[model samples]
Target chain A: MPIGIVSEPGREANEFKFITPDDEKLKTGEFVYYNVSLETEDEDSDLFSKTHKIFARVINRDECRGYPDSFLADPEVNPKHVAKKLGVISEDMELYRMTAKIIGYYDTRLNDFTNPRIVPKSGTKVELAPDDDLEKFLTNIEDVAEAFIGDLLHRNAGAVDIKLPVDNFTSTHLSILASTGSGKSYTCSVIAEELMKPDSRAAMLILDPHAEYHTLKEIEKMEEFKGNDGYKPKVSIWGPEDIRIRFAELSFREIISSLHNPSDAQEQRLREAWNRIQSSDDYGQYYSVNDLISECIPEDGSDAISDALTWRLRNAFDRELFDHSRNLSISELLEPGRVSILQLDTISAIDQQLIVNILFRKIYRERINCERNRDTQLDFPVFAILEEGHRFAPANGESRSLPILRTILSEGRKFGFGIGVISQRPSKIDDDILSQCKTQIIMQIQNPNDQDAIRRAVESVGEDLLSELPGLTPGQSVVAGDSVNTPFLCKIRERHTTHGAESLKTSKRWRESWTKNAQVPDKVVDADQDKGAEDREELL
Target chain B: MVSKKIGKVIGSNSHIDYTCEIYRKRDKDNPPTPADHSFGQFVYIEKEIDGKNIHLIGVIYDSQILDPDQGRTGPKLAEPHEQELFHPSYIEEKMTLAGIALLGYCEVDDDEFCSNEHCVPPWTIEIDDIVRTLSDKDFLKFHEVDGEINLGYYQNLMELAGPFGTDLLSKIIDQLKDMKPDEEKTLEVIQKNIEFSKRIKGV
Candidate 1:
């Protein structure tokens, strides 16, 4: 069914204006197309039909004709009635002029659109593109590796399932950018569930800063993820106390950053002791922070520098994380069909950065060794998602993890290592790190700086879609970049596992507490009040 | 039903408004009175265009009573009854003139009047064209175009009816509402708008 006719050329070359009486369906972001007859080059060069469908998106609409202003003067009289009295039909009263931007013709060979660099001529009939065609051409991905994340936004529910390729996003890196409480963690859980499906039994790691991903353990119990070949997925959770890093693995900078400001002489002495201990026979295999401290000798027969270094080292390395010869092995952290979550809710910000730095470095080197056919503990690929990515690779401040994360993001594709950075503040994340993730799932962001940062970094999302970000409700997102054929709005699917990061019910909890307090016996309350009065008198 | 002849076209002061002289009696009905040619009454003059019968529809907007013997100081020639016996054609000069504003036209077919009404007429009426009072049925049918109540000649009527065009249209719309009960609400809206415009424009 044809919806409208091309009225004239638009303000831009790739845009055209069409007149339509359909005020309901032909809204902004609607997909419509017109047929164009291609000029054949030769008589025998014919593999397809000459008539091709040129798709376009409706970008703007304006009313070109309506009832006169005077007809609407009387409040009680409807404008339609006035027009009817004047011998005009009700439907003919309003005429809308829709402006559409051409999205080019779909090419089967390329599985994408091929821009013809030409717009339809005037008087061409433009029809609404059917849902079947949109489902076929809008995305190009294999069905086997499809991660059924959500459906297309603005379309009817379940009209088009937006299935992204797990292979593309995992290999090239991915980012989930949204404001707080915008379902960032919920979308991540959905992806995790997809990865743990029977067809994909992917090895994954999540650096959960707030203990929000522990609910992923439910995947092991779900029947959907169990394979027919008796294969069941596994989830491993490591709390803050169990997350350890050997003291010897820290670099000179990492060690110095952990301490308060140290004098130049103390730093020099520490460096000397560090190098000496590193060259010793038992440095990496079996060593402790006590050894490093004991090795720091007095300079010029004075014990001032060594004594000060001793106190700082004891204070920084006394935590359970920096242990001696006790750290998680690479083989234990990553395995096929297993998800490992390292909960860092109890750790401080600086220690969290150092932990991420060490883990990423070890993972990168181990993957490289495995790819090169050398001795390695782990041989399979693994993808790690870092929650609150801005704390790891902040733009305004330095972090111990930023360099290694950047290195892994840039070169990890060949080595079968990938990173997913999830952050609420895109502007605070390093520009290079944010751009390296080729796949972006952007939700509602109210901050102008974050929106501008996305505009500058993400080239795939157009201005029209960017403007929709501020108005998007929770669970709606704009998926763009390599994983999708074109940028589009998506309504994220529900998570198979229960979400763990819901906001606390403050009002309900307060009411419950107040009710419980009111149920206390009157005699007990009087006794407590008498004791409180006696205690006040004693204090006075 | 046959249309009752009320008068004949006498003269015209303008192209759209024509003067018609009303008669005191007609053959098929009782003696015609002033009410037959009253203001806002539907009337038409039959004419032939290109060998086809057409009726030029109009409405009586104004009326005049001519007494040519007013203010005559001459001696009394005879009594009123004796004058009628002596000079039988003397009373003919005392006539009633009606000002008819042409609204539109309708085509006549077979025995039916106003088979299809048009808002614009291609021809004008002659001096002696017989003006007849349109029946209530034909009057309603003339306003019905394409099965809806269409006052397409609303602008023309407003322009040609002189100072009292708004009042005349209000009266016609009221009659139409009573005849067309289905379109009563919509016609009421139009009537309210006309009343509002009359008050604002002070016409």
Candidate 2:
């Protein structure tokens, strides 16, 4: 149904003004269209005529006509009721002048909008674009492997289902940027569920610092993720106690950075010891920390540097994470149809960084080897999600994992390795790494610094969408970049698995505590009261 | 029903305000009296446009008594009662003039008086057009259209009535309230507004 008529051209050529009596439906970001007939010429000068529905989005609204202010002067009286009493018909009382930006017509062959470079004349009827048409025009998800993320936000609930391209986002990196409690982790879980579905069985890993992703174990019980051809996705959660790292896997710099305030001479001595160990004829790719410590003794009898290096090495490597023979195996952590969640809640910040550093470096090299047809434990492509990404790759501070993360982001696509950097503080994340992620799912972020960081990092989200970041409620997101045809707001779908990251209900807990205290009995009888009395009498 | 023939149009100050001369006769029974053509009276003038009869609805706003002998110090040749017998033309010269502000018009078809009312009348009042008082039924019918009390020409009445606009409109609303009780709620709002406007103007 036609809702408005074009009034005139706007300040920009791609924009035009329209008049609508409806005050509610034509809100900002609403899609509308007007039909236009055009003639095209072929190579032989033969003409073909066709009609196209030119689409536009409502950007702004101003009240052009309404009930007089005096009618609303009395606080006790309703303006509409007053207008009705005054014989001023309600239908003609309110009018709005809306400014809409042209999105052009959808070209099916190109799978994108084509600018017609034409504005509708005054008095052209502009109708609301139906949800079915928008569903077809928004994304190319018909026969391709897709992840059902959510629905289009501005439309009615369940009107338009938003399914993102699985292969596009999985190959290219993805980023989930949101403030605290904005359902960023929940959205990640939804994506993980989609990846584990029967249609697309992907090998994915989640570096969960808060242990929130363990709920994804529910996928093993869900039939939706099970394939009819005897395929079932696996969920493996490795807690802090179960994770192990080898001292030989850490680079020289990584080992130095993991120590607490290592002196310059001690670092130099450690590097010399590392070089000596690597150059020895008896050395192997799998050497223990004891071998490096043995090589660190000085030949000149300088005991200070060597003793200090031993103390720091023993202090850093003497943990459950570093083992001589046992470590997280690549073949077990990454399978063709399994989701491995490495929980790091019990580990400290430095240990967390070291773990991510060692794990990502191993997986990245294995992916490269697999792509080259070399013998590798991880022969399939893998996507990894790093929670609290800023901790591993700080912007102002240094981390052992920043360089490896940057390498994986820039060169991982070619090697079938993708990384999703999920961070609440985008400003603290490394700019290079944040920009390298080709697709971004941004929820509400109120901090100006984080919003500015997103603006600098993500290029696909326009200023109009960025302005709406502060007002978006939880579970609402603005998805942009290569996974979608255009940047648009999305109402995230409910997760298949139970969400584990909900906030603590402080008020309900306080109320229950008061009730429990009030209900406690002040006086109580013991089972051996008479026996206790008799024993007291005997003692007296 | 045309209750009484009150006056005839003598002249017009504007397209909306007309002046009429009242017909007063002491010998005739139930003749047009001063009360019949007094202020705030709803009246209409009959006119034919394109062979269709219509009533130009208006209200008496002001009046003037024209006495030809007011300033004369010299005595007449006959007494006041004898002057009508000796000089009947002289007695007929003295008249009562009523100022009528046109509100709107209502179409008339045969005995069915008010078929429809329109705020914009295509024709103006002509000189010597007979003015008659509207029956109570016709007066109530004139203010109602589409099953509601419509005063679409309330602004015209206010503009043409000059200083007594609010008072005249309030009187019409008060009279219609009693005639149409079902629409009293809506009419009271208009009445209160006019009363407030009068106080605001310090009238």
Candidate 3:
């Protein structure tokens, strides 16, 4: 057979080629269909369902002889059977081929058979379809394993990588800011949990004014899961009786203020008597610092400590040398192996400030001294987290402990002393101390003043990022600063232990009480009250 | 670096060299006379420079000035001029000789006070003032030839010139042409020579 090529529809064929015996069986000028099956990865095979179609064409057997082997292989047949087999031919797949000259392609919603459509070859190098199936398959399986381990690990581990920030916090100060319900507390809990890990030798002391951290005791009760080597969180309570001090520690003014009333000359005599008593060997046995004050001093206008000293003097004059007072010294409070929580719940806000200031000053000074004494010069780092910091670290005036705190911020890195001042009202905290923090975890903050305070404190934060603060949902926070390599907007993991802290639900309580009394009739309550009234009248 | 002692009064050339092993103390106490007080209270002087009218303060103890071969020190005075000197700004107390050459002076009366409450006496010369005094040709020459007119250079030149003639400005231009700009080395020198004032100067 000979196949010829024609330039025009009615032009005579000039170029011709001989067809082999295999091609002779095909009818000349007949319409035939060519079918191609596209193969892909098994997982992605479903993507080709809509695109599988056979192309039909009329073959000029004499002219096809001049054609290539690929052209001769296709049958010169009508697409009549191809339509029935492919199921997409009657649905304008043929019309698409005639107009666009495309063979096989995946159909899209936007494709219109009435107009010429652009289609891709089944096995073409260029792919029009999205290639997400392979990536999706891999992600789906990996997500399952991630979820499984997620449950096994504590919530702190699943939260943002806090270790990097914690390590940075050792050298730099950090701040955590967030809005209400933005998991600020949970983030704090996570930090506390991480710090308490056995391998972490760092000591942490948190002043939880709202009693939100009571749930930590519950988290500690969980059985050690895999990878967690029997680490437990311990909490100790400290009262006023833990501190120890001597009369010499008192200032001259404090000693004078502790004396009882008499003439000016008598007051001098009282001071002399107090000095003589202090110098005796049995001073500790005959009188604690408090005993000397009560015997000699009048209780007119005196400081709280002076008043306490006077009261102690009048009460126990014969106490033994080993006698322990109710109030403990600073050393007792910071003793190792004890996570001391000085519960100020029963104390007044003013007293809490005074007490916290005393403790902070003592702790910072001790840590500095300890660092200097070490031969190898290793510091026992302690983190002091103060909740509701605005009350103690107020902005209006310098705190009594401000000097010690400033020293810690400026020089505590080498001494291993870290301080975390937590406050909802950032505007009320001292600006100097707030600016020193190198790490900050910010939650949703709706108050403009607080936001402005935070903005001023963290000079590097942009206004656009601060604008997003108020809308942040619960359990979410923006963690930024030297602690994190890059600022991250992260959803804080839920605390493993349920928080005892919660807003009061007034409506729910009312509804539950109403339901409980629904069984009793209103008339029954009226009759009982009337009966009780009658009985009382008769008795009277 | 030999510290060029400064005087409390303008046009006075008595310098207390800080680099000297022992501090020189005058046995006779000559308290400052009311006449000795001038609007430009602080003046710069070389270590050995002496004057009858000026009261001595301290010297410019800049390390860069000691090593003249390194070129960190600015242009030296072709000839030392005996005249009153004043710092442009109260913020700076000391500067290198090269630094002093770039900034020009603004003349003020001996009793004239500075408008700024914080600045020491002898009000600073503003860019506008400099432009007003120098001719277009001289101004163009300064702009093209003088070292970068940064805060340090301006303050240093003003201090060296004090209230004297405009010779320091020309010297700065010659120095800029003589040396090539080495940004890294220049910055290092500037960092090493920074000094703080002992007391707040009158404005």
- Candidate with maximal DockQ: 1
RMSD values for the candidates in order, in angstroms, are: 6.9, 4.9, 39.6
Alpha-carbon runs more than 4 Å astray in model 2: A37-49, A75-78, A84-87, A252-268, A278-294, A301-320, A323-326, A398-400, A514-540, B1-8, B13-15, B21-56, B60-99, B105-118, B122-149, B154-203
* TM-score quality measure for candidate 2: 0.82
Error of 2 at A181 (Å): 3.7
Clashing pairs in 2: none
If ranked by DockQ, best first, what sequence of candidates would result?
Answer: 1, 2, 3
Clashing pairs in 1: none
lDDT of 2 at A345: 99
Give candidate 1's whole-model lDDT: 0.85
Docking class of 2: incorrect
Superior by TM-score: candidate 1 or candidate 3: 1
Candidate achieving the largest TM-score: 2
All candidates' TM-scores?
A: 0.78, 0.82, 0.41
Instruction: Encode model 3's per-residue lDDT on A204-233: one tens digit a residue.
Output: 676766667766665445543113554465
- Docking category for candidate 3? incorrect
lDDT (10s digit) by residue, model 2, range A1-540? 899999999889889999999977877767899999878665688999889999887878899998765555556556665455444666657999999888888887678888798999999999999999888887777677899999988888889999998887887899999999998999999999999998988999999999999999999998888899999999999999889987776778668867767998888889999998888878677788878888888766749888888888887787778987777887889987899999999998877887887788888878888889998888888999999999988997587678789888999999999888899999999999999989899999999999999999999887778888998999999898887777778999999999999898999999999999987755665655533665765645
Off by over 4 Å in 3: A1-163, A224-231, A237-282, A285-324, A328-338, A374-379, A398-404, A510-540, B1-203
